[model samples]
Every structure is written in C-alpha cells, then in structure tokens.
Target: MLRMLKKMDGVILFVLLLLMVMSVFTVYSAIQSDPKLGNHHIKTLQFYGIGFVALIGIGLVNYKLYIQYAFYIYGFGIVLLILVNFIGGTINNANGWIKINDYLSFQPAELFKMILILFLAHVLVKRKNSTLHFWKDIVPIGLWTFVPFALVMIQNDLGNALGYIVILVAVLWIGNIKLSHALIALAIVGVTFFGFVKAYTSYHDEIFTFLEKANREHWAERIDPWLVPDKATSKASWHTKNAGLAIGSGGITGKGYMQGTSVQSGRVPYTYSDSIFVVIAEEFGFVGGSVLLLMYFILIHRMVLIALQCRDRAGPVVIVGIIGMLLYQVFENIGAFLGLMPLTGITLPFISYGGTSLLINMACIGLVMSIKLYGQEDEDELLMGEQRPTLLERLWSMVKKEKTTA
Candidate 1:
C-alpha cells in the first residue's frame, strides 16, 4: 500500500486538488441564487472525498487486471445499460439512469466509458503491436464500440454516445490502424457530418417535426444553436446565447467571484451542473478559464508522458483510450456553451458537479496512475529511454533525494 502510495504522481494529484477547489467554489457560486440546487458545494466536497478514495484505491491495484477481464467487465457494463433501459428512470429527459432508492441513483453510461476503454485496449493489445488487419482487427473493434454507442443513443444520451467513437478512433490509431483505412474512415465521417448539418438546416421544420413526433425534439434544440443560430427559437437558443454573453461579459479579469449577473439572475440554467464553465468564465474571466485549461494541459501532458514511458504494450493502449474519453468530454462540454458545438449532457471533467461523472473521471486517472506504478517490468525502465529521466521520475527522484539528504 505504501509502495503504491509512493508511486502516485504528485503533479497530477496536485492538479486534481486544485480542480476540486475550483469545482467546489464554482458550484457554490453557481447555486447561490438558485435555491433548488441546495448546498451543492458541500456535496461537491463529499463527492471529492469519495473520489480520492477511488483514485488512490484503484491506483494501488494492478491496471492489467482490468484488461484481463475486460470482456467480462464489458458484459457487466452492457447488463447495466440494458437494465437501465428497462428499469432506469429519466433524468434531464434521458432515460439512462438507475435509481438506488431516493438518494442514490447512478448513470450506467458514465461508468461504461471507462469499461469500453479497458475493453477496447484489451482488444487492441492482442495485435502485439503489429499492423491491425482490416477485417479481423479493425472491424471487430468497430463492432464492439458501436454496440455500446447504439445502446447509449437509445437512451437519448448523445454526449456519452459520441464518446464511444472518439475512444474507438483513438485506440485504433494507436493500435496500428492502416493509414489507408484511416483516411477512408475520416472521409466518411467528414462527409456525413457536413451533409447532416446541411440537411438539418435545409429541412429544419421537416426534420424537427419528424424528431418531435419521435419524442426527440430536444435533439433539434441542441443542434439549432450551433448549426443555424439565426433560425433557432429564443427558447431553443436561450442557454447558449446567454452563456456566450455571460462569458464574453467577463472580459479579461471578470466580474469578480460570485458576481456574475446572468448567473445570479437565472438567465442561464444548469450553471451548478453542466454549465459550470459559465460560472468560472463569468466570475474569473479569460484568465481564470485559461488557468483551468493550463492545469488540464499539464495533467494530460503528464499522462501522455506516462503512456510514452510504459514498458508494456497494453499499458499505453489503455492510457490512450482513457485520454480519448477525457479529451472529448472536456472539449465537448466547454464547446457547447461557446456555441461551437451542439449541447449535450457532457460536463467539464473535474470541475463539473455530478457525483457519477466526477468519480468515474477520478477513477480513470487512477487507472493512469496504476499504469505508472505497475506497467513497467522493472524500476530501471521507469526512466524514459536509456538513462534520460522522465518528468514524473525526475520529480519523484528529487523529492526522495531531498528526504534522504534531510
């Protein structure tokens, strides 16, 4: 246990702590004028407490164990998702959550993100770092990813659904996907997206009416602001419009903490949850948002270093998949509010206030930490090639050396 604790990455842990501070404060400010949210800042602290336990506890375990049973874990995840489809209650119009009595309901889709990462890595690692075969390797991976993607979409959770493809593309890239195959897939996706947007705008009413009849009108609400803001109803565009205005209002320095006019006045909804980025932007300005992103950059940079330094093939594959999961969530969450993308249920990775999302993300980091601790066959290999010290190893070595000198 002490050994695993010693292996923990100090830089990443420190960044998580900083984010916890930011999440708690921002959630507090976001809920100040909204009475229903009710002490979400306190709840944020409690969730972080549990999340730290998950982080360190999972980090202490060998990550390879996850890969070993990846299929079974995936089966379990599928069971949960399927179960939710039947017994799950709706939240925010998405019937993707299962209730555990009144005070404890969880989202299966959130947990499945990590499961699919492990499962996909397990599949990719079987190629032994060789070029993946088009039919045998690539097709199987796509099928596996698509199954969960379809399931999540069935529940109307577009944010989590998009994540499966992102994870698939990432693992395939690292898994030695053929350049020719990659280019073809890329072209298909580009054409599909462009055509969808053009069609969506051209036949707005026709498509929206179809969606409305199918009980998915919210889909139209999400896309209209991004694709054709001019045509979006005030009701459909209000969230992104006010969010953008509030963010722009912050200027360089911001309106001061907890002083966001739009936020306190209830112009933007979900500020305490998915729109939490608005609070940080409105209260602290571009400087604050930049600082938060800088921390995220450092966190990702450190994990990428860990992946690059790992001696095991599977170690890097798992890390890459996890990286994809996180990068998509962070980018999409912030992008939706900026009107650069359609709104979805995705939220800022660590800075958002949700028990399930925060804990699952912390566990993903734990999986990364596990790779750093156990992925190597020996301590000597912890250094990056030959004798060059990795950033993690150098920082850790200095800390230990200072203790020895003392």
Candidate 2:
C-alpha cells in the first residue's frame, strides 16, 4: 500500500491542493458578499476533505478493473438517470438531482460523465487501435453516448447534457476516428450551427413565440442573450449582462478581496456557485484570474505528460477523455461569464462550490492517478527476463485480453 501511494503524482497533488485553497478562499469571499451563500466556505472545506479521501481510495484501485466492469457501471448510471426523471426534484432550471436525503442529493448526469469515459474506453479498446469504421464503431458509440445525452436533455440540464457530447467527440478522436469522417462531421456541425444562428436571428419573434407556446421559453432566454442581444428582455438577459458588467468592473488589479460592488450588491446571480468566476475576477482582477487559469493549465499539462508516459493503451484513452471534459467545463463556465459562450450554468470545475462537481472531479484525478500507478510496466517486468503477473495484471487478465495494449 505504501509503495502504491508512492506512485501518486506529486505535481497533480500540489495543484489540487492549490485549487482547494483557491476554492475555499473564493467561497468565503462570495458568502461575505452574498448572505444567502451562508457558510458555503466551511462546506467547501468539508467537501475538499471528502474529495481527497475519494481521490486516494480511487487511486489505490486498478483502473483496469473499472474498464472491466464498465458495462455494469454504465448500466447503473443510466438506471439512476432514468430514475431521476420519475422521482427527482428540480434545482435552478435543471431537474437532474436525486435527493438522497434533506442535505445530500446527487446529479446522475455528473456521475455519468465518469462512467461514459470508462465505458467508451472499454468499447474502443475492443477495436484494437485500428481506424474506427463509421457504422460499426463510430455510429454505435454515438448511439451509446446519445442515450445519456437525450436523458440529460429531458431533465432540462443543458450544461451537463452538452458535456456528454464533448466527451463522446473527444473519446472518438482518441479512439482513432477516420480523418475523412472527421472532416465531414466538422462540416456538418459547422453548417448546422451557422444555420441555427441564421434562422434564430432572422425569425426571432416567430421562434420566441413557438418556444413560449411549447413552455420552453427558457431556451430562448439563454439563446437570445447571446444571439440577438438587442431583442433580449431585461429579465431574459439579466444574468449575462450583469456578469459581464461585474467582470469588466474588475480592472487590472481588481476592487480587492470582498470589495466587489457588483458582487456584494448581488447583481450577479449564483455568485457562490456558477458565477464564482465573477468573484475571483471582481476581487482579484485579471491577474488573479490568470493565476487560476495557469494552475489549470499546469494541472492538465501534467496529466498529458503522464498519459504520454503510460505503456498501456487504455491509460491514454481514459486520460484523453478526462482532459476533454475538464477543458470543456472550464471553457464553458468562464466563457459564459465573458459572453464568449452561452450561459449553461456549468460549474467552474474545482473552484465551484458544488459537492457533486468537486467529488466527481477529484475522482477523475484518482482515475488518472490509478492509471499512473498501475498502467506502466514495473522493473521486474522490464529488467528481469520473465516475471509473474502483478496482482493488477492478474485481475486484468481475468476480465479480457488485448494485444494492442501494454
């Protein structure tokens, strides 16, 4: 166990600790400004305490065992997702959380993020590193991914719903998608998005009326603020507009910690949760924001390096999926505040004050650490001529064998 603990990545550990510090400090500042947040900073510390425990426990386990049981895990996550639709309560605009009790509820959509990666990695490993055939490989994978995507969308959780798409695309790319198929997909997505924008801008009133009649006007509320700002009502565009104002007010050095007028005034919504970036920016300014971003960059860079060094094919596949998810979450969250992307209410990853978000993200680190710990060949397997399979290897062979992997 001590030897396994030695395998943990020191760089990643330090960065998580740093992010934990940042999260706690930011949450404290947010609560000071927004009374409704009430001691979330204390809760943030407790969540981090639990997150580290999860990270260590998960890291000690062999990730191959996870891939081996990927199907069962995927089915379980899907079951919870389906169950939420029947018995869950709504939070904000999304109805994706299942209440375990009065104080602890979880979003299966978040849980599915990790499960999807494991299952997709397992599915792709069966292809043996060859270029994926569209119908046989890519299509089926898309259909598998579509199951959760469609389910999350039904819950009105657009942010988590879109995250599934991000994961599927990233995993497929690493799974060796064909370049021609990739190009075609790129073209189709581009044209579809462009056409969507065109149709919405051209027929704003008609689209708004249709959405209103369908009781899905919230969709228009989010889109109009981004697409046609002029047409968006004060109520519809209030969040984005206010977030923009708060961030812009935080010039070079910022208004100083706990001194953000906009944030303290509560003009920005969800400041403790989704809009935490606004607090960092308002309090610490561009410099503070850049520092946090640098930490994220370094953390991802370290993971990429670990993936590159991994001997097992599955290690890199899983790491790439994780990378894609983290990148998308950070981009969408901060970008929404800057108006570079539409508001999706996606948390700012480690820095955001969501229990489920923090726990899942920490577990992702543990997954990466597990790969780092178990995915490489040891000295006995390398220097010695022939050696017995280690315990992890024994468990792996029990599941399935893959010639393409290390």
Candidate 3:
C-alpha cells in the first residue's frame, strides 16, 4: 500500500489538497454569512473526509477493472436515474434528487456522469478499428449517450443534461472517428443551433405561443429571464442578478472572509452550491478567485499528462471524458456568475459544497491515479529502435560479417 502511495501522482494530490482546504474555508464563510444555514461547514468537512477515503480506495484499485465492468456500472446508473424520477424529491423545481432523510439527498445524475465516461471509454476502445458510418457507428454512440441524457432532461435538469452532451463529444472526438464524418457532424450541429437562434429571435411571439401550447412553459420561464432580463421578475433572474452583483463587488483583494454584503444579506441564493463561485469571488476577491482557477488549471494539466502517458486507449479516453466534465462545469458555473451564460445551477467541482459532486470528482481523480500507477510506459518507448550495440561490438559484428562474405 505504501509502495502504491509512493507511486501516486504527487502534483494531482497536492492540487486536490489545495482545493479541499479552500473549500473548507469558503464553505465555512458562506454558511457563517447566513444565519439560517446552521453550521453547514461541519457537514462539508465530513463530506471531504468521505471523499478522501473514496479517492484513496479507488486509486489503489486497477482502473482496468472499471473498463471490464463499464456496462454494468452504466446500467446501474440508468436504473438510478429512472428511479429518481419516480421517487425523488424536487429541489428548485427539478425532481433529480433522491431524499435519504431530512438532511441528506443523493443525486443520481452526479454518479451517472462518471458511469457514462466509463461506458463510453469501454465501447469506443472496443470499436477503435471499426469504420465510421453515421448509421452504423455514430448512431449507436448517440443512442447510448442520449438515453441517460433524455432521462436527466425529463427531470428538468438541463445542467446535467448539458454535461452529458459534453461527455459525449469528448469521447467521440478521442474515439478516433473519421475526420470527414466528424466535420459533417459539427456542421449539422452548427446549422441547427444557428437556425434555432434565428427562429427564436425573429419570431419570439409565435415561438412563445407554440411553447405555451405545447405545455413547455417551464422552458419559457427558464429562458425568458436570460433573453429579456428587463421584464423578468422571476426568482431565477433575481438569483443571477445578485450573483453578478456579488462578483462585481469583489474587486481585487476581496471584502475579507465572511464580510460580503450580498452574501451576509442573503441576497445571493444557493451560495454554497450553484453560486459558490460568487461567494469565493466576493470574499476572497480577484486574487483568491484567480488562485482557485489556477489550481483547476494545474489539476486539468496533470490529468492530461497522465492521459498522455497511458499505455492503452481506455485510459486516455476516460481521462478526456473527465476533462470534458470538469471543463464544462467550471465554464458554465463561472460564466453564469459573470452573466456571460445563462444560470445552469452546476456545482463548481471540488470547491462546491455538494457531497455527491465532491465524492464523484474525487473518485475520478482516483481513476486517473490508477492509470498513472498501473498503466505501462508510453507506446513510443516500445517503438524506439532495438538497443544499439556498443562501438566495439558493432565493429566485431561487422568483421564477422565480412569474414563470412569472404
């Protein structure tokens, strides 16, 4: 065990520790600012403890074991998502959480993200040599991706649904699909997105009327705040407005710990979860926030390095999916805080105070560590020319060959 520990990636481990320390401090400040939150930092500490255990436990296991049972794990995730729809408690109008008790809830979507990565890595690596055709290859991959995506969408969880989309794109890109096929797919997506935006902007009333008639008023309610903020008085828009205020107020050095007016006044909703970035920025200022972002950059860089050193296709594919997941969440959450993107209620991976998200993220790091520890040397090492003979040995071999020829 100590030997394995010694072999683990130190840079990734250091980044994880740095992020955890920051999370503890930031979560404590966030809870302290609001009297109603009631010492949530204690719970956050417990989660970190649990998450660290999971990280170490999974890191010690062979990552290829996950690849072998990838389908089974994915199936289990699907079942959980389906079950959550029927028995889950609603939070913020999304029925995506399974209540465990009065103070605990489990989000299947969080676990599903990891499972999707595993399954896709397994399937894509298995089909590495298969010819790429839309109907034959791409369609099956799309269907596999869309199943969990549609299930999450049904729960009105657009954030996680979008996360699934990112994972799919990452896996497909790394899976070595034909270049021409990938270009065509990208073109179709681009055209579709452009068409939707044009139609929404040019025919707002007609489109809204259609949405109302089709019983998609919820979608309208969520989108309207972003598209027409001047007239939006909804709670979602209110949250975004305050989030922006909190971020903008924090200039360079921040207002000091637990001293944010917006946070203390309880104006920013979801301070410890979705709006945690706002809390960090408001209290720690631009420097602190930049430090956090630097940690994330280092974490992602280390993961990419591990992926590159992997001996097999599965290791790199799995890491790429993880990279996609983290990148999207970070981009979406921070973008929403700055009002550059619509609020998507996605947690900021390690720093956010969510048990399920933190645990799953730690598990992902463990997987990467496993690849680094167990996977063989780079294929380039094997591809290098056979060991060269010493100068004397080479000369002796040449003399022997000449004698034979004579």
Candidate 4:
C-alpha cells in the first residue's frame, strides 16, 4: 500500500485536494445567505469524503479489469438511463435524475460519461491495428456512441449528450481513424452548423414557429436570447444574464469572500451547482478564477503526460477520453457563465456541488492513476534493455546514472 501511494501521481492528487477544498469554501459562501440551503455545504463536505474513497479505491484496482468488463458497464449505464426515462423524477424541468428517496437522487448521465469512455477505449484498442474503413470501422463506433447519446437526449439532457459527443470525438481521434476521413466529417459538421446559424438568423420567426410546432419551444427560448440581447430579460434568459453580471462585476480582486450581492440576493440561479463559477468569480474575482484555471491546466497536462508514457493502446485511449470529458465540461461551463455559449447546465468538475459528478470525475482520475502506476513498468523495462539505446533512451540513462552516482 505504501509503495502504491508513492507511485501515485502527486500533482493530480494535489490538484484534486485543492479543488475539493475550494469547493467546500465556495459552496459554504454560496449557501450562507440562504436559510434553506444552510446545510448544503455540509453535504458537499460529505460528498468530498465519499469522493476521496472512490478515488483511491478505484485507483487500486487494475484498470484492465475495467476494460475487460466494459460492455457490462456500458450496458448498466444504458439500463440506468432507460430506468430514468420510465421511473425518474424531474429536476430543473429535465427528467434526468432518478430519485431513490426524498433525500437521495443521482444523475446516471454522469456515470455514463466514464462508462462510455471505457467502452470506447476497449473497442478502439481491439481494432487498433485493423484497416480503417468508413462503413466497417467508423459505423460500429458511431452506433455505440449514438445509443447512449440518443437515450440522454430523450431525457432532455442536451448538455451531457454534448459531453458524450466530445468523448466519442476524442476517442475516435486516437482510435486510428484516417486523417482525411476525419477531416471530411469535420468539414461536413462545420458546414451544417454554419447553414443552421445562417438560416436561423435570416428567418428566426419561421424557425421559432417550426420549433413550437415540433414541441421544442424550450430550445427556441434558449436560442432567442442569444440571438437578441434585448430578449435577455425574459424568464428563460434570467440565469444567463445574472451569471454574466456576477462574473463581470468581479473585475480584478473582487468584493471579498461571501460579499457577492448577486449571490446573496439569490439573483443567480443554481449558485451551488451550475453557477458555482459565478460565486467563485464574484467573491474571489478574476485572480481567483485564473488560479482555478491554472490548476485545471496542470491537471490536464499531467494526464496528457501519462497518456504519452502509457505503453498500451487502451491506457492512452482511456486517458484521452477522460481529457475530453474534463475539457468539454470546463469549456462549456465557463462559456455558459460568460454568455459566450448557450447555458448548458454543465457543472464545473470538482468545484461544483454535485455528488454524482464529483464522484465520477474522481473515479476517472483514479483510472488515470492506475495507468500511471502500472502501465509504466513495461516501458521502463524496454527503456533499460540491453539493446542499443536510442538518443532519448541514452539521455535518460545518463540522467539516472548521474543521480545514482550522487
């Protein structure tokens, strides 16, 4: 156990601890002004304890075991998603949560993020050396991605559906897809997105009418405010407007801890969850937010380093999928907070006050840690073998010999 602890990625563990500590402090501040949510920070702390255990426990297990059981994990996630559609309760007008009781409910979509990554890594590693064909290679992977994506969309959780898409794209990028084929697909998506935007801007009224007829008025409501700033004062745009204001108000140093007027006044909805970034920005200002961003930068950088060092295809592929998940969440959450993108309700990974997201993210980190600890052994042997060393290996050996001589 002690040896394993020494082998763990210290940088990642530190970042996770820092984020959890910040979560407790920020959540406390965000909830202090509200009588009803006074104890929410306590729950956040409890979740942190649970997340810590999950992180270490999952890290101790061999990640190959997970790859072996990838299908079962993916199927279980699908079952949970299907169960939510049938018997789940609604929160924030989205039927994505499954209530186990009055006090306990979880968003299965969060768990699905990790499961999808595992499944993709398994499939991609299996087909790593196979010939890439649009029909034979890509379609099966697309079908795997589409199932959970369609299920999540059915639950009206567009933000998480987008997350699934990000994971798929990331895996496919490293999954041996042909460069020209990937470029062609990206070009098609780009053109389609531009065409949709042009049509919407040119004929918004017609688009709105069609959306209303199609029972997607909620999407229209979200799009309208982005299209016309004048409409931002509407109920649908209330959260975005307030979030932007809170972030802008904290210019440099901020108003100080627990001193945010918008947060105290309850103007920004979901301050402890989706809008937690607003709370941190409003209280700690741009400096604090930048510090948090720097932490994430280090975390992602370490993960990428591990991916590069991994000797096996599955290890690196899994890390890429995780990187995709974290990157998309950070970008989408902060973009929505700044009104640069539509409000997606995606929580900031560790800093947000959600048990499910926090736990799942920690588990993903645990998987990365497992790869770091176990995956490097084989590579180290190869590096120090009796064969003629490459330039890089010779340099590495010299460094090691110097340290030993010292």
Candidate 5:
C-alpha cells in the first residue's frame, strides 16, 4: 500500500493536507470570538480527521469496483437529488439540503457530483475513440451531465448546478473531445445566456410585480443589490458588503489570528462556514491568502498529473472531474467574498464547515488514490506514445519499458 501510494500522486496529497490544516486554523479564527460557537472549532477538526481516514480507506479499495458500480451509484445519486427537492431543508433561499436530525445534514447534490464523475468515466472509457466528434459522440455524455444539472436547478441550487456543468466540461475536454465541438457547445451556452438576459429585461416589470405579489422581499432584493450595490441596503446585500470589508481590512500581512474586527465582531455573515475564507484573509492577511491559493494550485496541478499518469481513461476522467468541481467551488466562494463574482453560496471545498461536503471531498481523494493503487502505469505510457510519433519513439518506449520493469 505504501509502495502504491508512492507510485500515485504525492504532490496532490501534500497540497490537500496543507489545505486541511489551513482550514482548521482559519475555522478556529472564524469561530474563536463567539462563545456560542467556540466548541464548533473542535468539532470541525474531528470531522476533518474522520474525512482523512475515509480518504485513505477509499484509496486502499480497488478503483475498478467503483467503475463497476458507476451506473447504480449514479442512479442512486439522481434519486437522492430528486428526493431532496421535496424533503430537503432550506439554506438561505435554496432548498438543497436534507437535515439528519440536529447535528448532521446532507446535500444530495454533493453526493451526485461524485457519482456523475464516476458515470462520466465509465461512459467515456467504454465510448473510447467515439468521443472524437464531441456532439456526434458526446450527446450521451451531455445527458449524463444534464440530468443532474436539471435536478439541482429545480432544487434552485444554481451554484452546485453550475459546478456540475463545469465538471462535465472539464472531463469532456480531457477525454479527447474535438476542439470544434467544445467551441460549438460554448457558442450554444453563450446564446442561451444572452436569451436569458433578454427575457429578463423584457419581463423585468412582470418579475418585479410578482416579487411584490409573492412578498419575497429577501429574494427580490438580490437583483437590485447585485445590479447597484450602493443603492441596495437590504439584508441580501449585507453579506456581500461585510464580506468585502473583512477581506479589505486584512491588507498585506493580516491583523493576526483572532484580531479581525469584523470577524471578531461577527460583522461578516457565514464567517465560519460558507464565507470562511474571508476570515482567514482578514486575520492572516494576503500572505495567508496567497498560501491558501498556492495550496489549491498544487492540489489541482497534482490531480492533473495523476490523471495524465492514469492506466486507463476512467482514472483520468474521474480525477479531472473532481479537479473541476474543486476549482469551480473555490472560485465561486472566494470570488464572491472578494466581490469578484456574484454571491453563490458555494462552499469552499474542504475548508468550509459542512459534514456532507467534507465527506464527499475526502471520498473523492480516496477514489483518486484508489486509481493510483490499482491502476496500471504501462497502459497509460503506451497510450501517451500513441498520441506522439516516431522510431526514436521505440527508443523512448524502451526507456519507459526499463523504468516500469525496474
């Protein structure tokens, strides 16, 4: 097992560990000022430890078993998403979570993202070269992606829905999709988005009128605050404003742990959870933020390297999909906090305090490790050779041969 892990991607594991540690420190700072939530920090650390164990355990299991169960897992995941729409608890305005009594809750969508990756890997591995012509061969792939997207959207969890789509695009691109197909898909998305904007403009009066009728003042206020921040003073904009202030106050080196006024004063909403990164930025400063960003870059970079080293297409697809999910969520969470993007309640992967997300993220790492443990290296090198050219390739092949044999 040690030999196998060594053969796998060490850089990714190192980066993940660094980020996990960072999360504990940051989460501690975020909650330390509040006596009501003082003990929450300790509880979060325990969850992280448990998640680490699960990640290692999963890594030890054969990745092939996951492939075998891809369809069933995907089916179950979709069903969970569907169930959550009716039975799920509301967080903010989005109804996307399921409460498991007082201490634990689960997001079916989080579980679904992992399953979708597995299913995509299974489909792509079987479809093989057929994926060359994107649309011609990738409609089935789109179906696999969209079913979850539609379900999550119905749950009104746009952030997670978008996360799912982003993962699909990343896996599809890495799976050897045609460049033209990618462009065409992008074109379609642009056009659809444009149409949505136009429709919103034309129906603006009607929507505003309906907002009054429904008395959804909280939900209705988002558009105005987002559109014109200075003019919007409602609760909808308060989270965004306070988050920005916390990040801005951090300056260069930060104010020191537990020294942030807004964080300590509890000015920033969701500081210990969805917007935890802001607290880290405030107290630790830009230096700390840069370190956190570096950790993410390393984790992503290592995951990509692992995918490239995968014995088969499935491993690469799985790894890339997970990479996409993390990248999207990180960008959404941090971007919104820093006022770079819209407020989209997406958790900051392992850093955010959520049991379901932490478990799923660790489970994702486990699968990547599993691929490393049981995966064949020779097959990937051969595939890599096929993508290149020449008789020196034979010489190059002999070198790889020696390396594998050695």
Candidate 6:
C-alpha cells in the first residue's frame, strides 16, 4: 500500500500532506476553546483519512478508465448541483452544500470541478488538429459546461459558477483552439457586457427589470456594497477590514501561531475558511505568506510539467482543468482578503477547512499519477487518428513525395 502511494507523483503527495497538516492546525485554532469546533476537528480528520486512502487507490488505476465514465459522472454532478439549489442548506448566501446529516455536509460544487475535468478530457483527447473553433468545436462542450454554471448561478453561488468558466477557458486554451474564434467570442461577450452597463447607467428602471428577471436581489446587493462602500458598513466589509488589520498587526516576523489578536478574538470573519490566509499572514507574517505562495508555485509548476509529458490529450486536458480550479480559488480568496475584489466566499484551496474540496483535489492528483504511470514514452508522437509509423513507412512516403515533385 505504501509502495502504491509512492508510485504517484511524490511532490504532489508531499504538498498535499503539508496542506492537510496546515488545515488541521488552522481548524484546531478556530475551535480550540469551543466544543463544537473541537468535535468538528475530529470529524474532519476522520474524513481526511478516508479521502487520503481514496486518493492512493485512485492513483493505482489507469486514468483512461475515468474517461469511460466521464459523461455519467458529469451528468451526476450537474444533478447534484440542481438538487443543492432546491434542497441544500444555505450558508453565506450560497445554497451550494448538501446536508448529509446534522454533523456533516457535502458541497456538490467541489465534486463538479472533478467531473468537468473528466468530461472535457474525454472530448478533447481524440480531437484531430488542435484548432478548436467556436461553432464547430467548442459549442458542444459549452452546452454541458454552461448548464451546470447556470444552475449554480441560480443557486446564488456566483463564486463557484465563476470557477466553472475558468476551467472552460483553460481547457480550451490547452486544446489549442482557433485564435480567431476566441477573439470573436470575446467580442460578443464584450458587447453584451457593455450593453448591460450602458442600460444600468441610463435607466434606474432597467436595473429593477433585470433584477426581477433574475429573481435574485443578491447581485444588486453585492455590487451596491462595492459601489457605495461608505454606506455598506456591515459584513460586506467585514473580511476586508479585519484581514487588513491582521496583516498590519503582524508587521514583519508575525505574532506567532494562536497569537493573532484578530483571529483569536474572532474579529476576522470566516477566518477558518475564506479568510484563513489572513490568519496565516497574521500569525506567521510575511515569512509564512511567502512560503505558502512558493509552495503553490511549485505545485502548479509540477502539474504543468506533467501536462507537457502526457502523450495523450486527455491527461493534459485534465491537468489543465485542475490548474484552472486552483488558479481561480487562489486569486479569489487572496483578492477578497486583500480588498482587491469583493468578498467572494471562495476557499483557499487545500488550506481551507473543507472536506469535500480537499478530497476532490487529492483525487485529481491521483488521476495525474495514473496518467504518468501509463503515459507513453517521450519520443513517441501521438498522431490524431493513426497508429505508430515505422521508419521504413516514413522513408517510403518521403521518397514518393520527392518522386512526384521530380
């Protein structure tokens, strides 16, 4: 069993372990004095153990098998998202979690990321000529991607829905789609966005009309706080204000773990989850922040290296999808903490205390290991729709072309 785990990418596994350790520390700090948090800590650890086992087990298998079930898994993921919208528990204005019981809950949006990767890999792996065009190549994939995004949006979970768009763009770029098609699509999106802005500026009535059609005042409220920040003195600015104070209080070296005044005093809202990075910054200061950032750089670098070595398109596409997920989460979380963006309820990837997110991320690493295990040799070229070519066959083709030219 140990050897099996070792067979996967060792760097990824090590990084994962480090992240898990960090999360436990954060969780412990969050609820060190409270019974509820202490109990949650135990439950979270147990789930993490199970997730680790699953990750290793998944790595031992061939990744191609995942491709076979991609569609079904993707379908199931969308269904779960839909279910969460109607019946899921609401926390932080986003109905993205499915209550499993009183003690545990699962976030379908997290699972949806993995499922999207599998599905995209299946479609793009066998694609001939990496030139993906919009109407011809991307539209079909967009249909599947958009449905889940729309459903998540309806649930008022803009953060996760935005994450889906990130994955789609990353995969499409990796697949080497036609550049002209991308420009055209961008133009269309730009035009629509401009129109909406103009309408909002010109008519107050249009804003109400749009809000009524969406059936959610949350969008307007979310922006109102940002636009007229002076009036929005509630939790709208809670994470931003507290996180800044935490960073300022730390100075250069840090206040030491559990010594963070803001975090320990519960002044930093969502410190255990969305604003966890702020806690790290406050306790460990710039030293810890730099180390965490460096770790992420190394992790992303390894993932890219794996993508480059993959002989099959599916493996590369999957890695690309994973990259997208990580990138969005990092930027969103950090940006929110720094007040660079609105306080979007996004987690800090492996560092955030979410069982579902952590498990799915480790599972993705397992899949990457499978790709490496079964990956073709570096020199072998994967033709779009053909078998390996013999040396003689290649020479004969070259000779025939020369003769015809003569």
Q: Write the per-residue lDDT of candidate 3 for residues 1-406, one digit (tens) a residue.
A: 9999999999888888888888888888778756777767778889888988898899899887787778899999999999998999888767999999898999999999999999888777666446556787789988999999999999988899999999999988888788998888899999998797677667777877897797666665656566667545565477888888888899998998989999878898778888889888998899989999999999999999988888777889999999999999999999876766677779999988898899999999889888898777542211231233567998999999999999
List the pairs of residues colliding in candidate 1: none
Mark the 10 consecutive residues where model 3 has the least summed lDDT. 379-388
Work out the TM-score per prediction.
0.92, 0.93, 0.88, 0.90, 0.86, 0.85
What is the per-residue lDDT of model 4 for residues 1-406, given as tens digits with 9 covering 90 to 100? 8799788999999998899889999999888767888887889889988987888888888787788778898999999999999988888757899887777789999999999999987777666456568888788889999999999988878899999999999988888889899999899999998898788878877877897797777776766667665643488788888888999999898889999999988999889998999998998899999999999999999999999998877889899999999999999999876767777779999998888898999999999999987776553322222244577999999999999999
Best by lDDT: 2
- Give candidate 5 regions above 4 Å deviation: 1-8, 132-136, 194-205, 210-224, 230-233, 377-406
Expressed as tens digits, the lDDT of each residue in 1-406 for candidate 1 is 8867987899999999999999999999999887877878999999999999999999988887777778899999999999999999999989999898777679999999999999988777666678988888888888998999999999999999999989899988888888999999999999999999889989999999999999999999989999988888999999999999999999998999989999999899999889989989999999999999999999999999999889877788888888888889889989998877799979899988899999999999999999999877642321222334567998999999999999
> What is the C-alpha local distance difference test score of candidate 2?
0.90
Minimal lDDT window, size 10, model 6: 377-386
In TM-score terms, candidate 2 sits at 0.93
Clashing pairs in 2: none
Pairwise lDDT winner, candidates 1 and 2 = 2
Where does model 4 exceed 4 Å of error? Answer: 213-215, 231-233, 377-406
Backbone clashes under 3 angstroms, per model = 0, 0, 0, 0, 0, 0
In order, the Cα lDDT scores of the candidates are 0.89, 0.90, 0.84, 0.86, 0.79, 0.77
Residues 68-104, candidate 2, lDDT per residue (tens digit)? Answer: 7789999999999999999989998789998989788
lDDT of 5 by residue, 1-406 (tens): 6775576567767777787777777888888667777766677788888988888888988776687668898888988988888889998777888999987788898888888888887777766555465455578778878889999887767788988889888888888887888798889999998786576556766766786786554544655455546545567688888888888989999999889999888888778789898888988899988988888887777777677766676788888889889889988888887666767778888888778888899899899888777666444323332333456988999999999999
Model with the higher TM-score, candidate 2 or 3: 2
TM-score of 4: 0.90
Candidate 1 clash total?
0
